[model samples]
Target: MDNIDQIVDARGLACPMPIVKLSQAMTGMEVGQTVEVTATDHSFVPDIEAWCRKTGHQLIEVNEAEEEIKAYVKKTK
Candidate 1:
């Protein structure tokens, strides 16, 4: 895994919450900074992907475990 600048623990959060927190965190991050989001919501996979696409961020990696979904996103803009 790449060096993470921040970690957003949205494991118990639902749908938009994970994305919301991600956006909030990214607001304070510089371009090229990476954030790792760990969520329990299964929908986060597509939600995070869509958010990245819309915001021009880079989705570096995605890992799905038995109980958690992890996504590493890098700010591009």
Candidate 2:
């Protein structure tokens, strides 16, 4: 992602902590800004998707590879 405003590396973090960090990053961002989050927890894929749906934020991309998952999210509200 070219214009990513912030990057949250939650690679080692588990469960809610990764999501927690992502949420914190979002709060500091402006609308249309984006945050890149990487987490090791496999379950985080669905969790992040659900979060985007609940928050009304835009989930740009999510890719899982090499035992890691990378997600790009943009703050729309």
Candidate 3:
């Protein structure tokens, strides 16, 4: 929350949309910059983690609520 450089609001989106937005946001982000993505998809948590691992980014944290999930990713490369 404090150090996040971008917030991608993918709350209403379905599968893969949130990840798409996050990937796009990462395109122009500087190394070490962070992006927060909020989504309604429960699968977003694991999706983001896998994405981070595949992309070589850092998965800072993930917070999930009843209605939504939030993921923080930091660009590492």
Give the per-residue lDDT of model 2 (tens digit) for 1-77: 69988999999888889999999999999999999999999989999999999999999999999789999999999
> Which ten contiguous residues of candidate 3 have the minimum total lDDT?
41-50
Among all windows of 10 consecutive residues in model 2, the one with the lowest summed lDDT is 1-10
**Which pairs in model 2 have colliding backbones?**
none
Stretches of candidate 2 exceeding 4 Å from the true structure: none
Candidate achieving higher lDDT, 1 or 2: 2
Global lDDT scores for all candidate models: 0.92, 0.94, 0.92
Q: Report lDDT (Cα) of residue 73, candidate 1.
A: 95
| Clash pairs, model 3 backbone | none
Q: After superposition, how far is residue 11 of candidate 3 from its true place, in Å?
A: 0.5
**lDDT by residue for model 3 over 16-67, one digit each (tens)?**
8999999999999999999999999998988998999999999989999999
- Supply candidate 3's per-residue lDDT for 20: 93
